[model samples]
Target chain A: MNTKQTNEMQIEFDSKSENEGFARVAVAAFLTQLNPTVEEVADVKTAVSEAVTNSIIHGYEKKRGKIFIRCIMQEDEIVVSISDKGKGIADIKKAMEPLFTTKPELERSGMGFAFMEAFMDQVDVISEVGIGTTVTMKKKIENSSTFRVSGDELNG
Target chain B: TGEVKRFLRDDGMIKVSRSLKEIANKVRITKDSLNGTLNREPTLEEIAQELNMEREDIVMALEAVGEVESLQKTIYQ
Candidate 1:
């Protein structure tokens, strides 16, 4: 098997809902070399969706701006990093807490970090007020061969 | 994806057949990690270790569940 390819893919697009979905598909396809399962792909895609959504809605405050996404694949693992140079969060701890949101008008779930944690094994958020925010996420492929579906029963 | 406790369908194709337990397991997820793949979110590695499934298989499974849910809903009246 390939030792794993690590490279960064960058794309700047409008902070829009539709574009967020597009980015996820594009990234997933690009990372197909890791041979990620459907579920694994979906998991990463969701996390990306959440991060990009955060960048657009919270970081840019829904205003016109740019979003950057990077993907890195290492032996048995894939790392994805998302960063936005918009108004960075002063308190990442507070933003990560479930149900905590700075904007209620957007119906923000505030579960972005929670979801990221739930999906990825290791996730780190780096943010500097007035600078930008970067989220580093990693997932090991070796973990997949071990998730046994317990007591799964399919019937008509 | 997030706590994918169970997958109702087989091979991530379609839940053409599924028991109550299976459907409940797939539908009763507190999160949309699997269903919300259309958007780019960070990658979640724990699911592989927890579910013992390949990344592609997991996505297909979850997408199947989502499709099944929509199918069942459409059958209504």
Candidate 2:
């Protein structure tokens, strides 16, 4: 579907750790038209990778499932949502807590949600025990022209 | 996800380049360490010296890994 407000793309693939890199690179590639800085692109990729990994490792628990990733570009911002139909987080708030992981034996590090929040301007996680989980993230890209003008003004 | 692309290394080995986040983790450092330094953001040379890596490697590895882990890893089990 197409909307006047934003350009959107949705992709669904098997839930696997190997696909994590793909998800991030695809999103970063789609964002190339915006000419984001390497840092900005890396930030988005890291966030995307974390969310996707959570869906694969935690949501499906290494089982076979489908991961849905949707990307929307609006004006000077990019919104990406990763969703999965698998065992959902029971306590989202606790899950978001840094270093709080249910699977410590797996060396999870339990910092997925924290990374998502730090990289994106906004992160919203919605989940239900048996239903599913969706992580929506939005990032505002600073326009180069505006940035240059502001820098010039400051110097002048 | 999309199509997969694979490339071989020059030494006939399959080399997988690590992400910046992974690189940062290997050094046991965070972006804040670099940001916390004096007047302005330090150059790649400065960061390389701090990390004990080559300037080129640091430049190539330079990226925003974001703050992944805020707390030290403790034995929870």
Candidate 3:
């Protein structure tokens, strides 16, 4: 349970949908130091994708702004924080509810927070009405010694 | 005659589907070639230009497929 921070990185990019893949891949690459399983990597990537997409589509409303991503790698876990300085969520409770989306017209399935919570060990959200929103997520990487015998266990 | 008119009427949707498939194929090929040339993952803009599509379109197409597949897996599991 040694939780000493080992490494960290910060990146700032425009809040554009095109950078969604970049943000996900960049965090996944930063996570290579932990030697995570393929499933672990995919999980982090999915969570990152969801969070970043939320920032771009919801936070900025497709307007130009800055999206910031910070990652801190501890001995056995990684914490990622994504923030955007745009219109923030008024009611986080409603926003986090599964299948609740303000932009149903955009075909948003409203599962972003749900997916983040599912894929990550923890998810935290802080927001202000007109200031911004920040989402922090953490996931613990299982050591190779105790790695599941079969990936099917996740689905089972 | 009815079938022909219906096909023509739905041409917009059919064209979008065909182009999406085409864009997805070209994205794969472009990614492979770009990975060799750049020795890393190419950005969406790179793939967009190579395929002669908008960056937004590329993002939409890629995410649409990925989200649907993952959503299905999550639901079934």
Candidate 4:
């Protein structure tokens, strides 16, 4: 028997030379249940691209490394964790500060965390300087079909 | 999408420890104007038509962010 309580998926990829669009498309396809608006979908895809890019370009520092991405879907929420086994950030606080990228030459805006914080309901980062970094993010779904807010409004 | 992560690139409020007015000023002035000029591929007329704001206003906004970060909220909604 399969015990599939909440649908979950995991992907492992090289931290060097990974395709951004591939990750975006895969995540979008897996999230088909949301029936999300195009804007919402775009938002999520962009966010994923940013996170993965950071892992590949910054976390791994152009060296070979492993990136782990996990997606879990609950009734009204989706959670994602992107982790990397590489030289972790020395300072999580400063790293998260807006426009504080270690690699400015790569055209990084340092707004990755800011964008994540604004779009998602919650975001947390855990890192150890010599070990790795983990980014856990969550978003609440706005599905009216599950519950009605008022009689005047329709789910459609 | 399921695995999306929002990008946050701005370096906001460096003077948070100093004063709220300083924070407001940064919000008001520190945008990299060059971004608005070179990074923005749109023409002045296009921005004017899309934003419903005067061309100069659009220029001002772009000048702040180095480029237009967003066209207009109306475009999305």
Badly placed stretches (over 4 Å) of model 4 are A1-5, A144-156, B1-77
The residue pairs that clash in candidate 2, if any, are: none
Between prediction 1 and prediction 2, the one with superior lDDT is: 2
Over A1-156, each residue of candidate 4 has an lDDT whose tens digit, in order, gives: 954346789988777654665665566555544434333444566567778888888788878888888998776577888888878889989988988988777664688887777667788999998888899888765631222233232211
Estimate, for each residue in B1-77, the C-alpha lDDT of model 3 and write its tens digit: 98886787586433323466566667667878987898865654456557755444555455434532454466449
**Candidate 3: Cα lDDT at B5:** 64
**How well does each candidate superpose onto the true structure, as a TM-score?**
0.60, 0.62, 0.64, 0.59
Q: Top model by DockQ, which number?
A: 1
- Docking quality level of the chain pair in candidate 2: incorrect
DockQ for every model, please.
0.08, 0.06, 0.03, 0.02
lDDT, candidate 2, at A156: 18
Identify the leading candidate in terms of lDDT: 3
lDDT of 1 by residue, A1-156 (tens): 865445556767887766886677667755555655655666677778789999998888888888888877665677888888889988988988988888766643676787777667888999998888998888876544322233132112
Q: A53-154, model 2: which lDDT tens digit per residue?
A: 999989999999999999988767889999999999999999999899988876648777877887789999999999899999999876311111122322
Q: After superposition, how far is residue A64 of candidate 2 from its true place, in Å?
A: 0.5
Candidate 4 per-residue lDDT, tens place, B1-77, comes to 32222222133322113243443244333223422664633333333333333333333332333322331242234
**Steric clash pairs (candidate 3):** none
- The total of clashing pairs for model 2 equals 0
